[model samples]
Target: MNGIILASILLRIAGVGYSLVLLKRSGDRRFGFFTVLLTFMAARQVLTVAGTTGTGLEELPGLVVSGLAILTIHYLDRYVDEEHRIKRELKDTNEELTIFKKAVEHAGHGIFVTDPDGTITYANPAIESVTGYEPDEVVGENPRLWKSGEHDQSFYEEMWATICDGDVWDGEIINENASGEFRWVDTTIAPVTDGGEIEHFVAVDTDVTDRKERQLRIEDQNERLGRLNRMNELLRDVNRRVVTTTKRETLEETVSERFVSDPWVVSTAVVDRTASGRLRTRYVTGDETAIDAILEDTEEAISTLTAAVDHGRTMVSEQVKALSNDDITGDTVGVVPLSYRDRNYGALVVVTESSKLFEIIDHELRTELGDTIGSAINAAERRRELVDDRVTELTFAIEDADAPPFELAAATESDVHLTRTTTDGDGQRIVFLKVDDVDAETAMTAAASISNFSDPTLVSAADGACLLRFVASDTLADTLACHGATLEALHVESDTGDGEIIIDTPVGNDVLPVVEALSSRFDSCELVGRQEREPTIDTAEGFRGELQADLTDRQLEALRTAHLAGYFEWPREHSGEDVAAMMGVCQSTYMQHLRAAERKLTTNLFGDERTSDRRPAVA
Candidate 1:
């Protein structure tokens, strides 16, 4: 019995090993079968061995029963271990799935999933809030249902092209919701890919309608403001040009031409202040009849404008009832003060039918225009004064009066006393004479004693002085001859020194020979001066003294000789032929020199040719 038990144990172990191999291959719970086989093998072996090498049927039954019982216990233990491991794995997988689902559903931006044909497959709750559509309603519907059609076809074309290329499309879009209300959205659509091929599209969007509208309004306002600024700049440029011109006609024309299309300017006028302190219209644009009537009643206009000025304000009136009997319709008038140096000069009246036209006429523009008009008026007045002064001086010089009297006294008592007198006829004839230095009676006796003094008559006599007037032929030559006599007889009791004198005379061709003779005689002792006086325009080319009158060649030559012989010099100096050549002429041929020399001499002796009439030639 002990040997049988040992063999049965060995058979049970072998059977369990074979059954374990079978269960491992079958992938089923075969461990129980393996244990039973092991028990049967052990029992069989024991029975055989116990029967002394003979088979035993009763031993086989006992061996099989013991093997089956052991196999069942082993197989059951293996199955229990596998079941516990599978349960643990299943629990972990469920936890991970729950986390993923929560993440997808709770995203902030409204997320949408669409099929390749743009059909909405899924949408988050955020989509309902943004588009006013429930997730169920949007799903399976074309995403284009939300399109506002505000975006052009090209816009959608580009969007679809980008997505089909597996690229993300990001931009602004206008969309319509379930309520048919339009809205702007900032959207991003990206293609979902499966194995590198686009499968569907996912779009995330946010509402941006309010921000977009605000930006557009701001842009429009900026554009309008920019246009207004440009208009103001143009107006300023026009104002600058208007203020710079002084001519009345030019000013009016410029203003009318420039502002012809301007709604504020119905007409333009330049009002000049008269000597009587009343304003008169000098130039005007538009209907002459109206302008004439307005100018005729300037006092009333002035009174109205003055009231406006007194308040230092612009006057706006809808009707001319205050100045005219007629009711002027369809007109608005703005009267602005024109001032210079803070003093009122005149007024500018602008007329328009539109009240808004005056909106641009602010204080700054009014003040600037006022200043410009003032400056132009002042400049015009100065030019007038200058012109008048010139005319006065010319009148005096041409008349050949005794050049008023020399205000400065002579430096010496011995200086020759020069007296001037005019002839009775026409009074164009002028003569200078010398009288003996003696008491009046003695001078008269001496003058009566001179037989050469023709028609000698006493013009004036006083205090040892006597003035004798006589008609002399060739008065200029006679004057020079008398000066020579005075110079030669200086030691004589009644001598007046070498009578080196210049004569103011009319120029003519016959005067040349007489001038040459005088020049030869008075080569050292005295000098002769010749001058021609005539009326001429006070201009650069027409200005001259001796040559003032139309000159003859001979007369011009005579004048030239006189100029070169120290006649026109400052201290009465001389430079004969050499000076004449330097003046671009031969000594005898002095007409050309006379013209140029006279121009220079007159400019120096008088003033510039432009203002030459204002000054007289030095004695």
Candidate 2:
């Protein structure tokens, strides 16, 4: 029995210790009840082993203590459970707070936290890098240090109000950094509230300065490209007219008209220097009177005009409103020089009142415009020279004096080309005749109808013309010495007999006796033109009467038409196709007429034997 009691006591003690350790480790209320049960068994086992019997007072005290101990165990277990729950919740909260702090510190965007009064409390490393300020410099300072003047006071007030109202604010802001340079940012501000009142503000900002700058640059470049394209279009439209015009008057008129028609220009004029060095107004359009008014009022305008021709450079003059009238007030006049191949012709003056419009006419653009006009002038001048160099003046009429019938032959002067020269063959005199503008059929008809020559040997009859080799005896020179006409001097000949002849005469020589002698051979004769021109210089007066011609009526008309229509220079300054179009003829036909007139002119000047005597032909 003693051994049993001792073993029971020891077992009970071990169970109580184990239960206490479980309660401490697991914080389980059930483990505390097991500890209390073990304690009561240990107490009862000790009392029974001591041979103690259950008495009234002693047992009652033990029972009360036991009851108190049981109650203490139950409440102690619940207390431990509640304490463990609180510790777990606190640990989780602390872990979450640590994660949030690290996130804020490492963020790429600038993060700043401010107190309720807008004083900066914390600035992340990113905020310091973006604002050019260290954390120490920004903390405790107001965000006003970063404000840029781009936004008004009202903007900041509204932003602050939104944040203070426990709301989030998002916007773009231009701020100045520590370097005194402005930066753009996309920013969001959130108010952090505690105790039902706004306590702090948190801001996240992303640097967007580079993006904004790129956008602005792209817009500017696009605008400039559009402007350049428009200018090129205008230049192309003007150049088309410049290339086709072969006359100075036409070119000037076109330029002035086009310029005036543009919304920019008010008036325009072309001032050319005459060969004598005098300024002449060649062409004008769109309030042309303004040019005259300017010339009369401002001596400087005349100087500028002279400078344009003498220096062959562009010049500009401005007439303020005080010096100008309603017709042309506050005009910015640009005198563009007309020069080509280092030759100066004159100035093309353009005027406008708007300064902005004048800005569009840059130096390079003005030069190109001048070059277009200059090229046209150069082409026109060359054509004029070609026409003027061939001028011929003479008169000739012929009829048979033998009372024999002469056929009044007729042919287009333009359709016939004749060339004659005197040559020697085998110690004998021969006249070479090359008749052109004839096809095989025309050659046959001409050969059948003409009895003027003997022994005509056909040389070559091809390409709508004929080359004939003629065999003439020495009697050719003596056969018609009285006729006094050389092969090369036969000019403007027509079957209807309306043509002219050249006579090389000194100033005092009387041509009446020789004319009378020639008239005796023909039934009648009359002089239609005469000219004793001296050598000419490059002047207006020198070039006058440039078309002094003794051409047949048909030949004269052809030459005149060629000159007026610029057929001489039409179709891009060299091709006369346009002249053919205007004259209602094929290009070949028109060329035929023009070449015939030119041939007749060349012959009359140097081939006519009458002119070799140097005597004037008089009626």
Candidate 3:
């Protein structure tokens, strides 16, 4: 028994020491809990050792204390494992946040987070780079601060509507930078959602100002091209009509209409040099009063245009105010020389609102229009020249004294009823006699035969009442002597005279003086006809006859028959075949007779003056 008590006491002491050591090694909280559990277990174990000699109740206490100690150790281990797991999860979450933040800060695109109301929640550094604004300055501000006002308020309203509806919106936006400059941006706005509810808005933007500007420029160029095409078509139509028409009035009207109808043309006018070399307005569009003002101030305009045309250069006035016209107000005036084949004909003055607008008119278009107007003017002038030529030719044909004879035989064969005669027997004649009444035929024949003659031939009609002057030819001296005879006696006179005499004759307002002067000198001489001299044909004088022809029955019969025939009409009123048939002969035979008759009559009437002996031949 003594040995058992001693061993138990020693074991109790060792257990206490071990329990103290364990409490110290475990931390303070675990230490207090372990001390209590170990003390209970030690007391139970001591009791069990002492009860071994007595009841089993002592073993039960020891068992309960040991079970409590095991439960405390297990709980402490679980607490420590739970704390370690929480720490590891916290570390992983922090690392993920660091990576996300790094990505957001360094992103290339401008990222902005805003409330559903468009208030900026967060702006990345890219926002400052793109907008020239500090992130802090823009944060918490409504995105509308960047609105350029170029787009209407409805644009922003639509954007908000899309974002609030949880839909992504993408479009271009014109926005103002912090520098107060406008910038175009391509933006995408997406709604941020939490549990099916919109929580915020996110916008991704790209600076697209350069691209937008380029697009606008392209559109402008296309519009200009369209305008150029229309101008080309208009020019072509004008060319076809204006260049071909000879009427000056038509061309002027067309130009006026075109100028008034064109939206781009501010004003237009045609200026021409007058006889005095001063520029005169011929046609104008815009305001007539303004046109008058321009004309009044045209000394300088004329000077400028003359310089341009003389130099064959284009003159562009920096502004219309620089032009001489005080009434004209515009930014630019274009003076284009109108020319054909390098010859300057005129100048076209075009006024415009802008210099750039004038520049837009293609060089080829101006050149073509200038040439067209010049050519039209040239054509019109040429037509006038032709008409003048025709008139000149007709006057000369009527007035020439030594004109080719009217073929009486051909006239007779053609059944013409006009009597043809000459002064005396000289065919150098001004007037061809045609008797309207047979009662006057005798007096007319007698007046023509005795009038003035170097060579004379008389043909009496088949009836006893009339006679015809068949042929007459006289020299220039003889003709002039006859003219002096009529001039010496004041009387109504008509006679074929020398070329020099006809040239010396007076005309126009001077003619009546000549007639009066001659009437005071000659008795039977009266001024009966006036002669017209023209460049293209021969010249002659007209005369009044007071004497008639005396001839045999057969000669007078032939003369009357010839006078009844159509011969003197231009392009012949009767055909040669018909004339030959009327003459009772073959066409060829009758033509030969007609030629013979013409030679005989011309030679007898003109005599020595019929050919080169009379006057020098003219071209």
**For all candidates, what are the clash counts?**
21, 13, 48
Q: 1-619, model 1: which lDDT tens digit per residue?
A: 4544554566566656666665665445556555565656665565556566434444656556656656654566566556656766777777777775565567666788998889999898788767889888899998788888888999989989999999999998889988999988889999999999888898998888889999888987785576457547646765776667755446556654564346445555555454233546656665334445455655555555555443345566654443343533225556666655534545666555454455555657666666676566555545554443321110001111111111001111122334443455754444334343444455445444443335556655554445556554433333433222111111111222223333332221122223333444343322223334442335555445434454555546657567557666777665556555655667766645466656555554433323234423221
Span of 10 residues, lowest total lDDT, candidate 1: 392-401
Q: Is candidate 2 or candidate 3 better by TM-score?
A: 2
Instruction: Report lDDT (Cα) of residue 326, candidate 2.
Output: 61
The sequence of per-residue lDDT tens digits that candidate 3 reaches over residues 358-453 is 566656667667777867865664565455442111010112222212222122211111233224333355232222223344444344434343
RMSD of 3: 19.0
Better of 1 and 3 by TM-score: 3
Question: Residue 33 CA error for candidate 2 (Å)?
Answer: 12
Give the per-residue lDDT of model 2 (tens digit) for 229-260: 66566677778888888777788888788877
Look at candidate 3 and tell me the lDDT of residue 364.
Answer: 61
Rank order by lDDT, top first? 2, 1, 3
Model 3, residue 73: what's the lDDT?
A: 57
The TM-score leader among the candidates is 2
Candidate 2 local Cα displacement, residue 484, angstroms? 42
Task: Name the runs in model 1 displaced over 4 angstroms.
Answer: 1-104, 217-619
TM-score of 3: 0.40
What would the TM-scores of all predictions be? 0.32, 0.41, 0.40
lDDT of 1: 0.54
